[model samples]
Target: MKELQHLNKYFRKYRFKLLVGIIITMVARIFQLVMPSYVKKSIEVVEGYIGNNILKSEAKEMLLEYILIIVGAALLSGFFTFLMRQTIINVSRYIEYDLKNEVFDHYQLLSLNFYKKNRTGDLMNRISEDVNQVRLYGGPAIMYGIQTLTLFVCLVPLMFIKAPVLALYALLPLPILSVLIYQISKIIHKRSTIVQEFLSTLSTFTQESFSGISVIKAYALEPKVNAELNNLALDGKSKSMDLAKVNAWFFPLMILLIGISNIFVIYIGGKQYIDGEIASIGIIAEFILYVNMLTWPVAVVGWVTSIVQRAEASQKRINQFLQEEPNIVSTVKEETPIKGKIEFKNVTFTYEDTNITALNNISFTVNKGQTVAILGKTGSGKSTILDLIARLYDIDSGEILIDDVPIKELNLQSLRQSIGAVPQDAFLFSDTIKNNIKFGKENSTDEEIIAVAKKAVVHENIMGFNKQYETVLGERGITLSGGQKQRVSIARALLKDPQIYLFDDCLSAVDTETEEEILNQLKKESKNKTTLIVSHRVSSAKNADKIIVLENGKLIQEGTHEELNSVEGYYKELYMHQLSEKEK
Candidate 1:
């Protein structure tokens, strides 16, 4: 319930509709209460005529009038009940929509480290399944709760006013029912939380299995995967059964208590009637009607309690993520223009998850229109430099500056927008080739897309496809080959035409001939842009204005291509080895 207080703002947001629903509920119950009284009147009128208290014609007219009033009141009550559901249930749906958007927006604001700490499937389950559970509380539980309260308010006092002793006996089992519900509800809350957590785990395992199905088949691990999934399903079934067992107690308990109340109404009221302590037997019938009227609401109490407990458990999960503050917050509100002069001054960074130092006291400066190539062996921190430049992770020590302004002081969006980065592992969405390219620049013309595809040397391959750029890709662009995916990724960055271009081993998949063609085009296209190309091939770095070599997270060499080649060091050795391979 404390976690559920988060929804109070939404309740206030649609307070007008909820108020209307409440009014409709009260009116419906009031009209429904009119039925028992009219029923009593009809029964009394029949008794009067039998005892020679009234004529047949007058009695018939009175009975017909009472029947019509009862029918009319029933129809009105049904109509108002319909309106009550419309107003209240609709508000619940509105709140669900708002809550999902709120969670998604918060997810976007969080840093990459947050994603590293959480699984995708668990995040998805929180936004979807957990939210659905909360919706049950927001809609049906609230509606039935109000309905029960309205019936109690209108019916209970009427019963006591007519016959105090009978009312006392009829309500005797309710306190016991409440005590049972309290104990059951606590158990339900604990079990429901466990069930929801197990569901998240199951969802995570299933999602990962599906996403990596190709790997499973390649390794012939289908049997192993299926056995694991079966184990998870069996565990989930056990947890769900535990919850169902507790819930199964609700209705039978309610019915038993209600049955006892009905018996009390009959026996107690009958004794009073024979003693002439009551005016008529119709009063007993009226009391019986009132007790029966409470049946659904009383039955719903347990159901509502179960729903609230489940909802509270789900809300607590949702609140855990919603309260997370983003680590990388934009310091500047106003947008700053970028001219792509990047400087790294004694930057040190370590991966938090692995605690591996990716960069150590790395310092470099790139002028506004300089082309710098970074050459390094695997795990030598070439890619980390580009990530730091993009401000993906803040440095552990030292400062980064963009166009002479502290990187943190500049607008984060502006800084990132100015850079066009093609990572070592290119990722594409399950979308058309044209749309994937257009992701870099929405509303791009067909001519512009074709031009960039040619620049990236992927235009011919795309034209060979059946649908050209219109072909829809498989998940993560698996429909294309590795080289094609990389080229298409290059075309996307080329289309962006940002002030700074960071190419991180993007041409590793292409042949030397195609790589040369793409490099020539890139040299022409990026003439005035500040470019940083991180590659293993010396052919790619030979034409750069400056080259930097890294070894074991430390800068070992920095010079022009000719100077580095003249020196007998790592860059020259790599150049000689690559030159020999080309000669072969």
Candidate 2:
């Protein structure tokens, strides 16, 4: 219960709904308590009519009256129970919806460092299963817990009034029952936590396997994966069964105590009545009914305790995730217009958990409307430079500037909106081709979409499709060929018409002829915008106004393509190799 203290804010948010539910629960319990007296009266009526102490006609009328009263009491209890369920249950659903939304929104704000440290399946568990666990505690656990306690409070006194000695006997074993449940609940809490974590592992395994199914099948690794999956499933089952075993023992223990209490009432109360201590059999009947009524509250102790402990475990996980502070955050909300100038001044950075420096002492500048290209071998830190400009990861030292203004001090959304980046991996959503192209600008016109597609040299391919611009893609755009996906990415970036463009091997999949044509089109279209291209191929950067060559983590050479080609260096080597390939 102490672990669930954070839920007070949610309860307060829907206090009116919670209050109405509680009031209805109280009314239902009161109506339930009122029902036993009718049972007692009905017994008395039977005894009275049998012993000839009342007229048969009057007894018949009284019996019917008592029956009607009992029905009315039952109806009230059912009505209020239904109303309470509607209010409290729906409140839990509403809170779940709000909580999931808030967590997902927070995920978008988190930095790449956080994602690198966490697993996708674990995060998914927090959003879906963990949220449901919290809802169960706030919903049925709270609602039924209140009802059980209230029922116990109202009916216990009535039991004592009917037979004090029997009431004491019936209550003697309750302390033991509570202790037993308390101990079992701790074990349940530990087991439930283990089960949830295992489930997360299973989800992650399935997600990764499906995403890389082609590789798995090519490598013939189905047997190995299946065995691992089976082991995980078995582990989850074992933990669940451990919790279930405790639950199995808990209910019978409650029933054993309740069964003993019932026996004590019949034996002791019967002796008291025979000895003339109890005046009528009706009093004994009412006492028996009260004990029966008390049974559920005692039994529910285990069930609600299980719910609370599960929620406590789940809440701790959720709160820890929510408390994480992002590595990158905007320092300003409003700023002057960007003029497309980008400068890196001796910037250095290393990825988390790795000692290798990805970039070191890097410094360069691209004036507005000028084109710059970064030439490097694999892992020579070409893409890292572009990532730094977008502020995806903060620099370890030094500063990046745009038009003499520090990039970090600029608003994140505004800074990103000023530059259009086409990454090495072409990613597309499962939506219509037009929608994917229009993602950068939601209000883009159809003509604008077509115009950009034509410039990117993908309009003819799209028009050849059955639905053209309305064609929906499969997951990760798997339905399209690699070159088609890259062209779509190019078209999406072209439509943005940003102040600057960052192309990271954007045409790797296309044919050399088509790639050249698209590059020419981009050069024509973005003549006035700052453009940076990062590519391993010398051909891609040959036409740039300036080329910077990198080796290891440092810039080794900087000049125009003609100047680099004239020199006997790595650039010349790459150019000679490509010239030989073209000759073939």
Candidate 3:
């Protein structure tokens, strides 16, 4: 219930609708109460005729009038009930929509470390499954709760006014029912939390299995995966059954109490009439109708309690993520124009998850329009340099500057928008090739897409497809060859035409011939743009304005290709080794 306080703003947002729904619920109950009283009058009119106290014509006329009034009241009540659902239930849907968007927007603001610490499936479940449970609380639970309260307020007083002693006996079992519900609700709250958590675990396992189906098939581990899924499903079923068992107690208990109330009404009212305490048998019928009118609302008490308990459990999970503060926050509000002069002064960063230092007190400067190539072995922090420049993670110690301004002082959005980065692993969405390339520049023309595709040396391969750029790719661009995906990613970055281009070994999958062609085209296009190419190939770095070598998270060498080629260092040795491989 405390966690559910998060929805208060949404309640305030749609307060008018909820107010109308409450009024409608009350009006409907008021109209519905007219039925039992009218039923009593109809029975009394028949009684008058039987005793010769009224003429037959008078009795028939009064009976027809009462029936018409009862029918009219029922119709009006039904109509208002419809209106009540429209207002309250619809507000719940609106809140669900807003809450999902809120969660997704927060997920985007969170840093990469948050994602590294969480699973994709668990995140998906919170926004989808957990939110749905909360919706039940917002919609049906609220609607039924209002209806119950309205009936209890109106019907209870009418019952006492008509026959006080009979009313007392009829409502005798209600307090006992409430006490039992309170105890059951506690168990339900605890079990509901467990069930929702297990649902997240199950969802995570299923999503991972689907995403990595290729890996499972390649490793011939389908049987193992299937067995694991069975185990998860079985456990999920067990938890769900445990909750169902508790819920099963609700209806029978409600029925048992309701039956006791009915028996008390009949037995006590009949005894009172025999003793001359009450006037007419019509009074007993009216009391019975009043008690029966309360049946659904009273029965729904346990159901509404269960719904609220489940909602609280789900909201608690949602609040956990909603309360998370993003590690990286933009300090500047105004957009800052970028000229792409990047500087790293004594930067040292350690991966928070792994606690491995990727960069150790390394410093370098790249002026606007300078093309610097980074050469390094595996885990030499090449990719980390690109990430730092993009401000993906704040440095542990030291400062980074863009255009002579401290990176934190610049608008994060403006800085990233000014840079075009193509990472090592090319990730293409499950969309058409044209759309995937257009992701970098949404409003790009067809000619512009073709021009960049040609520049990346992927134009011919795209033309080979039946639909060319319009061809829809499989997940992560599995429809294309590895080299083709990389080139398409390069085309995307080229289309952006940003001030800084960070190509993090994007050409690793392509052959040397295609790489050379692409590099030559890049030189022409990136004439006055700052470019950083992180690659392992010497051929790729030989033509750069400057090349820096890194080993074991430390800067080892920095020089022009001509200077490094003339010296006995890592760069020259790598060039010779690659040249021998080419000759072979």
Candidate 4:
């Protein structure tokens, strides 16, 4: 219950529904308790008519009235029970909806670091599987369990009124029942945590295998993947079985205590009846009604205990995720309508849990409308620069600025809207080429999409498709070639008409001729926008306004291609090597 304290806001919203359900449940329980009394009354009426203690006509009328009353009570109970169930279900759905929405909203608010640190499949499980399980076992079970408790509490006093000694005897096994359930609940909580984690791991594997099915097929790793999946499935099965094994022992223990309580009631109440200390059979029948009412609440003790424990485990996992603070957060106040000028002021960044800095105290500035190219070997922090510019990561030592104002002082949405990025690995959804191109600018006209696609040298290819711009690509644009995907991504970024454009090795997948053509078009298109390109090919960087070379997390050289070609440095050696290889 303490673990679920985060749900107070949602609970408050549906308090009225819960209140109505509880009231209906109480009404149903009261009506249920009255049924046995009606039964006893009917029996009494029959006995009186037989003994001739009353006139036949009067007894017949009394019996008819009693029968009608009993039927009405039964109907009342059924109605209230139905209404309670309806209300509780409504409340459950509402809570589930709210909880799911909250989790999604939180996931969106998280930074890129969160995604890097957390698996997509695990996050999916947390938002989907974990939330649904909590709703299933947590919400309705708790509601009904509470109603059951209320029924017992209300009827217990009534039982004492009917036969005080018998009532005490009926309650004698309660302590043992509670202790057993308490211990069982602890086990359930511990086991449920392990089960939920295993489920998450299984979900991770399932999602990864499906997403990378192409890679698996290409590598001919079907048997290996299947074997791994089998292991995960077996683990999941064993955990679930263990949960069931613990759950199985609980109900029988409850039944044993309940059986003992019933026996005690029968023995003590029978003695009282024979001794003439008990009143009419109606009181005894009512006692029996109380005893029957006790069964469900006691039995539900097992179920409710399990539900509560499971919920606690789930809540802990959810809260643990929510507790994670984003590594990148704005440290300054923000104002919108920013100018597109970027500067890395002696910036350095080292990832957590790593000794090596990804980016050293590097400094560079890309003025508005300027085109800069970053030339680097693999893992030379080319993409890291773009990440810092987008504020995907914060610098450990220095700051980044846009238009002389710290980027952290600009609204995140505003800053991002001003910049458009096309990375090395282009991604697309299963949507029409037109829609994919118009992704950033939702209301972009077809002409605008065609124009950008043409600039990126992809319009001819799109028109070659059977459906042209309307053709829907497969998942992750699998139907398209790697170069086509890159072109589409470029077109998508181009359609944004942002003030700053970032091409992080965007031309790597395309042929050199196509890459040169796209770069020429980008040079023309970004005449008034700051453009930055990260490329391994010297041909791609040769025409840039300026080029920077990086090595081992440090800026080693900065110049035009001609200036770097004249120098004896890393860039010069790289160029000489590529030229020598081309000659061979």
Which candidate leads the pack in TM-score? 3
Give the candidate order by descending TM-score: 3, 1, 2, 4
Task: Name the weakest run of 10 consecutive residues (lDDT summed) in model 3.
Answer: 198-207
Write candidate 1's Cα lDDT for 25-73 as tens digits. Answer: 8998899999998899999999999999989999999999999999999
Error of 1 at 105 (Å): 0.7
Error of 4 at 328 (Å): 1.5
Extract clashing residue pairs from model 4: none
Overall lDDT per candidate, in order of appearance: 0.93, 0.88, 0.93, 0.84
Which sections of candidate 3 miss by over 4 Å?
none
Give candidate 2's whole-model lDDT: 0.88
Cα lDDT tens digits for candidate 2, 420-523: 89999999999999999998788999999999999999999999999999999987888789999999999999999899899999889998999889989989
Candidate 4's C-alpha runs over 4 A off are 332-334, 430-432, 466-470, 572-584
User: What is the TM-score (0 to 1) of candidate 4?
Assistant: 0.93
Q: Model 4, range 1-584, lDDT digits (tens) per residue?
A: 77788777777898888888878888887887777778778877776777788888999899899889988999999998899888877787888888888888778878876887788888988887778767865357856786777777777887777678888988888888888888888888999999999988988898899889989999999999999999889989999999999999977887788788777767777788788887555556666666766888888878877887888888888888888776666554554775678888899988764556888999988888888899888888898999888888777998898998887787777788888899889999999888989996999898899999999999999999999999999889998999999999999999999998999998889987898799889989899889899999887888888899998788999988899999899888988987887789
Angstrom error at residue 287, model 2: 2.7
Please identify model 2 stretches exceeding 4 Å from their true place: 1-3
Question: What's model 1's lDDT at 78?
Answer: 97
The local lDDT score (0 to 100) that residue 483 gets in candidate 2 is 92
Off by over 4 Å in 1: none
Q: List pairs with backbone clashes in candidate 3.
A: none
At residue 432, what lDDT does model 4 achieve? 88
